[model samples]
Target: MTDLPVRIRPEIAALPPYRQGKQAGDEAFKLSSNENPFDPLPGVLAAVQAAGSFNRYPDASAARLRDRLAERHGVSPDGVHVAAGSVSILYQLTQAAAGPGDEVVFAWRSFEAYPGLAVVAGATAVPVPLTADGRHDLVAMADAVTDRTRVVIVCTPNNPTGPTVTQAEFDAFVAAVPGDVLIVLDEAYAEFVTDPDAVRGDAVRAAGHDNVVILRTFSKAYGLAGLRVGYAIGHPSILDAARTTGIPLSVIAAAEAAALASLDAEDALRERIDAIVERRDRLAAGLRAAGWDVPDAQGNFVWLSTGAETLDVAAAFAEAGLIVRPFAGDGVRISVGEEESVDRVIAIAASVVESLPQTHAGRR
Candidate 1:
């Protein structure tokens, strides 16, 4: 038979798929993905159960949830836009703003979605390297933006590395960017940040900046990763642009109910966060005491910078029935979870680090 028309978009053809945490076997302790190990809050579960009429479509506008979010964040409903998840909102924003000849910029080793989204939107991705301390090199990122730059994503408390950009740094970076270019601040791990100087992107957006968009998700602290609900706070025009891109209504329903319920269960969520934070500190101290290069992880996870052979340590952990997210040559990221899980991860990490040759050095 004659070859079927084999034309596909060149950008898509050349793009690499985003890698997620591996789920090898049921026995594996799944710490590869930075997901909250706690169960959904009681209120959130009740809300989901009450939402039994699956026959009806969700409120496309997500009016109720939006209003709740507005109150919580001290913003108007017009500034809020809900989607299936933060990633979905990001994809829509990329498609809406980035196109041929435009460039998307973000820090290297940040959220993995930035590059793929840029490629999908037919834009050039400019990845600036992170600072020596593993925080976003905001100055370098701002300097990387040019006339062709359409979107710049800043993932603070970054995925692999847990360091966050300070408020002053973020302010300076935003001031340096062109007003027309969209600045996406992906704050997926915002809830875990205890630093008083940490940048709260939502507050930045609320201050009347037309170019800034703050993306947040219920998947983290709310224990609603499976619900796939997230929202963006930004200028009304930007929100309108993203909303124009259609999202599935069913996902929206589950997200809205769960998010609203999560809001009501703030105390329970706070307790969960406290526990995770304590565990994170304990694990970090434990790893450090064992002579491992563990950083001050402000998120619900820790990073072990074993330099070039991070994969070896990751494999060692895997062999011990622990699945960790390895950034190949970069480092291994281990998610903080329940007390027992956290202790087990630290124990395994200590053993792995000790077993590795002393030649494998750690970086900042």
Candidate 2:
């Protein structure tokens, strides 16, 4: 075959591939994707079961779900944008706000998708490393902004590292950011957070910040990962821009039904959240007690900083029929799931830690 044109965008070609946890079939305890371990909330299964109009197309506007979300968040329906998943919303946001010469800023190792989304949008990604304590270095991120900075993503109770950005820190960061730059807060795991200091997206919008967009997903706390529903709350104009670049409408419908059902089961969902929190704390303590350096996790997962031995620990867990997420050069992130799964993970982790050699060289 003749040589293909070397016309592909440099950013797209240079982007690192997105990696997910190993699929479920190979392992007994799969706690890699940060998914809610609970079964679908009451009425959720029935609602999805009732969604049988496979012949007809879904509502293009996602009007009902938009209305529900708007009412819940106390915003006009025009200010809401629904998509197949929050990641789709993120992609749309990048397309709407960043391009060619613009830059997108976020904490390094926060969300793997942020950098890839920035590259695809033809924008430069400026990643500010997290604090030594694994929290977002908001001050450093704010300082990284320049005239070309078009968007910034703050992932509260951040991925991998679970500490949240406090309201005070968020308020200060917002004040420091220029009005023209869009700040997208990805609160995918918001429902699981119980800290008084955690920043709520609804509170952010109610403060009347036009440049801010708050993203939420039904996948985590809502227990709707298979349905793929997520949304954004922002200025109407910004929502309009995101809508123009988003996915098909049917995915939107299933997501809407799942989300509405989830809201209806709020009490039950909260109980599940409480369970997850309890499990997370117990798991973290168990890991620490076993001599693993586990972070204070506030999300549904805990981080283990094993340095170069991260992959070895991951392999050991897999060998024991467990699955966990390993971050190159960073650490491993193990999700808190059902009681049995959590126990299996703790057991596997304890064995892995105990078996490791004392020195880095010995471990290697």
Candidate 3:
């Protein structure tokens, strides 16, 4: 690493940039990103074409899309805030809520971006470890809060690990947190969730907790990952603070158009989501049957608690033409990809689990 002549903030200098999942060659199934396998809706491209004004800047507020989302979520348009992606909104919320000497609390081994976001905001990152089953231990998280704590992020259908914070669990957790702390419910994979017990962000918004903000993205279930459009729903005042910290005009016209089109084609989108949910359930079940201690996967991916064998198992999957997200010694997260990939994952997983030592954590 080269040092610049200019002085850099030590925390900023120390922070590693966010890493995207590896891209696969044409032959391999790219399941590392937990991406939606389906293509964009039929109306999506046409909408992008309709909004083809390359010379013009996008509406900074993204009014139409905000209005549509507000209608869908039953919130006022001012309650909605759009950005480049939900992760971008997370950054904005972090900057808006926390700063030097403040603490940002979230589950460890969750989103790879959480810690970096806090650091970028000049805040201390308080990472509470997840439960053995790969679920957020909200009780422990609440216990981590202190006077310096400013923001708390709860990723439902938690990324990488694939377990959701149940509705009751979320309710209790919210009650435990102080009113001054902002609770950002990150539901990037909310559309893929089928569990009746899972927390619903929209319901939370309707209940009107001023400190809570719900984040959703067009990237996942809507299959608009390339466009990079996502929005937040919460109290207008809270959103105003986030807007103060956001990069202007980051949400472009094409992304906004595509999101609006996706909303119009909800029926078609629902079918794709339902398919992904079904695939995810089957994948989780197959891995478990293969003697892996798979977690409750409510999202569009499954977690393999590969423990000490993490990298080796991930490498084996890669050799078998499956690219999965590996968290070093923790586990491997395999997204529910093409229908054909499911059986391949199961076969490779069965062999890998058998190869592990008898006391390996991944073994059932």
Candidate 4:
């Protein structure tokens, strides 16, 4: 091996950086990233404009946002730790809880950010494979735990796959795991879930599990992806440690303001969310009706398990101006995007599904 720069950690040197979703052209709808389709609510936009006091640093502690969240979740202000994004909080929590020789467990093919976070934390990632139906294999995940295991992250409506862990399943998993192991429920897409059986982080944390932390973001449901504000609800001590590992003052004033404004405009936003949810359902149904064995899509997206056809399937989507996130050798995740984009995606997907040979993996 060649001599590396300033003795960078060999593993860090080998690790790949996070790859963002491909950007769409002006004529194409970008559904690669699981982002909200609606523009920021008018109120949120107003808040951002009013927060244009760029001359001063933001409140580093983010007390107002923290307190607001604390009240909503019925936790103390210190229990809420805000960051640039929920992914950032995930990284911070990883850093705070684990280091070299430690292991972090999560579902395979989950949020693409999971293994990357563990790598940066100098921890080993033990990714349990998802069930064939695209749900977390909770029993297998629990079995993967060893003494070196320090943290477990559960993402639901598991990204790229769209199946959510049920509250009962989550409870059973929690009961099965060791008490000392920290579990972070990544709920970035929680608001998009309509299933009554879905596991909700806030409810789990409220049940007095000191080892559990619930993560959420304003990026998805709140339509603040560009602004990057997210938070965690957990035991104060755990959150305090995560906060310390985070970049100080990283959550900007505009983001804080927009988050606050989002809360104030929750009713309006809920209506918008409702529309998206309806659209997501319609799209999922359309795909299934097209003979694609789509999974239970509880989020604002659907998972097309094309297996070996993943790349070819994605190319077909791109050819039709539907840019999707394709996990080669695995599947394609098509985010439920703009209303117009919905018809475009489903139409292209239907053609792709129909054109597939009878022997294709997803064919009934």
The residue-by-residue lDDT of candidate 1 on 1-364, one tens digit each, is: 2343787786677677888898757777788888888899978877887865878888888899999998988889998988888999999898899999999999998777888988888889899998766789888898899999999999878887888888889888889999999999999999999989999986687667789999999998888889888899988888898888746573657667888889998888999999988888888888887777665588888888877778888888899778889888888888885566766776777677766677666621
lDDT of each: 0.84, 0.85, 0.92, 0.90
Off by over 4 Å in 4: 1-5
The candidate that achieves the highest lDDT relative to the unseen native structure: 3
Clashes, model 3:
0
In the predicted model 4, the residue pairs found to clash are none
Whichever of 3 and 4 has more TM-score, that candidate is: 3
**Pairing residues by index, what is the TM-score of model 2?**
0.94
- How many clashes show up per model? 0, 0, 0, 0
User: Which ranges in model 1 have alpha carbons more than 4 Å from their true place?
Assistant: 1-5, 248-250, 355-359
Candidate 1 Cα lDDT to native: 0.84
Alpha-carbon lDDT of model 4? 0.90
Candidate numbers, best TM-score first, in rank order: 3, 4, 1, 2
Locate the minimum summed-lDDT window of 10 residues in model 1. Answer: 355-364
- What is candidate 3's local distance difference test score? 0.92
TM-score of each: 0.94, 0.94, 0.98, 0.97
